[model samples]
Target: MTNQLVPTSGSPERGIIVPVPHQRPEHFDAETQERLNRVDDAAFEAIAEGRPENTVTAYGQDWAAWEKFCAETSVPVLGVTPGTLVWFVEWLWEQPGKKAGTYTAPSTIARRVTGVTVSARVDHKVKLEEGVARPARARLTQLKNELAKTRETRGRGKAPALKIPHLQLISAALPDNLRGIRDRALMLIHFSIAGREHELAWLRNRHITRTDEGLVVDVAVSKNHPRIVGIPYGTRLATCPVRNWDAWKTAVEELTGEPVDPDEFAFRRIHAKGKSLMAGGITPEAVGDVITRCGEIAGLDIRLTGHSPRRGFATEAVKKGKEREAKRQGGWSKTSRAFEEYVEEAGIFEENALHGIGL
Candidate 1:
């Protein structure tokens, strides 16, 4: 008999229809079923642990976007074909994006295809044929090549590379206030740890380990990998991320007359004109906003994004001939084209062999 979906709760909304993976077909006995049930339980736990939270969110959003695409164009949600994937990529080119007058990015379009693929295999339990996806992948590759040749987006309103000097300038201009204290700490720790804004937002006092030399922060990178990032003591206490972090915590305790909870988020929403705190953690968007706000306060004319720190960290590492270490620290897989861009940015001019030979 085929393995059956068993309900754990009475209502459908309340944990009904749980999955049982790899249940044996010949396990008709009650004892065998119970043994398979234990195995299935472990399998479910592994499934949950396998994917990182950020990836989970992105994949969810990607699937939702696919559904939206299907709704708009009257395509079947699971009826994925090479033609349909190509159509989705073409449709994305017409949709509005964050960039003014631009459609979806090449990178985003590629990721959306991955979302549909995952949704088909996992949620719908249908493995897409290799033949069906290969053509679409080829088409996407061609499109990227075409765009590179055309240079349609050559430095037009593109956010500049956020280097160490830019951050130092922003740090120097931060106000000596509660909100500023939090912002400064946030930006510095974010860059030092080379984490995504979401990761930074999720950080709590519990992740911090203060030592005589510096601070050790346990950061959760993408794919749920945990890493220890060190922030050594700075020559100047005023600009030190560790000291600033401690000061912010101390200031919060003094203001509320209570020690910060280990489970509490490191960054929280500020109220009363940025002088007081609100409940719950600061959002991922707010983490990015702090960086942009700091830049604006420092009179920077360049645009900055939440992802700048991660890119900056990678580039800086590449500059120091530590590209592999940067890739590992930034949670980038060996085959990530996005991470390759950072490596290129760091070496494009610095590594040019014609630099001294030409002049």
Candidate 2:
């Protein structure tokens, strides 16, 4: 009546297996059990094994897109050829993204290729021989070159770099209420540390320690790794993260009618009608909502997300001529090639040659 299979375990080289959610029941003859086991294993492996939920979701989306494209084009999804990959890249280049009539970014196309490659080899057991992979690589190289040219002729994507004045305006514009206090605290803490959305949402009172200088926040888990970051006391009361946190924390304690539990989530949803708190931690999406709402109130018409604060921190720091400080604060690893992109994006205008001109 039951056929259960667990991932083989031994060495770290063997990947961790997370159970697939909402697994469907299959009624089959006992004779076919062995044959279907491998198939089921392959299906599960197609998913991101041992990966974070967000990563799994992204990979799933990439795979789904690839699958859809293959079906539509009458191309073999499994054992996909280099020619097919080249075609896929071209197809990606032609597709519209968020904006009307605008093509997708080259970076996005590159990730889709990576996702398809991994899924084909690891999950589908398709052989990606050097002969096949080489041409595909060459085609991708051509695609990159073409995209670079297009970027030079047109411009980069639509992520607007937020500034300090925008932050000040948004903060000042917020209504004087419990939600406002929470949002102000969230923004200050998020911007100061230059941490990711999940990092801010997952924070706990236990992870924060009072210090002589200001506050030491222990980011227990982040996109990179865990680290203890310092938030220095602000000379200005208007923009002080420590002060905002104290006010928010006091309000939270009062609403809960108990001392704030160190282990509990620092940020939670405040009920709209009353002063009651939600029972769970806030999501990363909620962080984006806060940014969007604040941005609207500040009279900006740009699409903002949770990444705004981190990106804003980098851009603002570079504008202030503190490139090294920005990298360190944002937890951007020195070894990562993506560091260059961050620098380029942040410092492109600030460090331009025209700055030195008398005109």
Candidate 3:
């Protein structure tokens, strides 16, 4: 005889039965779902939404750190509370060593916090359909409030201006060689152009155009916008022009040994004894190396880099700007916000202010 509730032989209910929760396949709640969704979306958007490459790389690093933290703590991202975020910030603060300490700058911390918050929000929202409830809006508010406080504490203080004597001394002591000549030219151009490292690296021979007025450099890519800079004939070099410009031109011509097309790179690799030595073009890191080597040769214990040229140019321009024409030749764009930074970094404004009073 077969029981009514229990199946007997050949009945459909003869096998063992298991139960499954339809809403929660993995047993994750709404908060977890939202956090997961938010992280995924943020990463995808950062890459796909035309964000700058540097920004994307930075966000990727922040996301990786957050993921590691969550995995170690066994905490679902959506369930991360303000308290947890505070701990993360504190962890960042205690990251150890100068590199890590510097990494905890206010801007860096803010980005990391933003990454985590976005990830949590997305994951929570996505899981809501599975019966997971959205987190209260107040939690987000609290997280932001905490982040603001941390930012206030982490804001960077003004650093002292890089010294001019240090730069002048270093420039004077650079070793005499083809590499040195190239470095010196790069230094001069960097200062004269107030160019970023990447811009300097990408400079081509065709970019330098000779107009009736003077030598004009057409900056295709710059921090603010594409612009043209002209250097008049009267500009004097502190060092010998033969070593600075003439030698550079000769070296470049020798390397190419032929008429170079306009699109070709102005700088090329130099060869010695039939083997290529150093290639031309400057990288951002190379700029720093040049400064360091110059410092070592000069026996000066100061931080210097390609940026020093820019600072030196601005400082000297503001000092020599008793005449309006001199100030105009400094290549400063009044319209750009970066002008203020360069001015401040060079301390040119302060120098000019003091000079105005004949102090």
Which candidate leads in lDDT? 1
Instruction: For model 2, state the Cα shift of residue 239 in Å.
Output: 1.7
lDDT of all predictions: 0.78, 0.75, 0.56
Query: Model 1: runs farther than 4 Å from truth?
Result: 1-49, 154-159, 221-224, 321-328, 332-340, 348-359
Per-model TM-score, in order, reads 0.79, 0.71, 0.55
Candidate 1, residues 21-56: lDDT per residue as tens digits? Answer: 664567568887788767766765676467776777
| Predicted structure 1, TM vs. truth | 0.79
Clashing pairs in 1: none
lDDT of 3 by residue, 1-359 (tens): 22234445687757544444355537778898789767777865654565433344556777677777777777665555666666666665545434434435544566677666644444333222221212323343454477678864332333222345654565577755676666666665665665655556667878876566656777775544556776555334545322364566666566658655567554444454432345555555566566556666778665555555555555556555422332344445555454456555445455565775766
Local accuracy of candidate 2 as per-residue lDDT tens digits, 61-168: 778878888888988778477888878877777777765656677767777877787777666767576666456567767877876788542113544555677778
Quote model 3's TM-score.
Answer: 0.55
The full ranking of all candidates by TM-score, starting with the best, is: 1, 2, 3
lDDT of 2 at 256: 73
Better-scoring candidate (TM-score), 1 or 2:
1
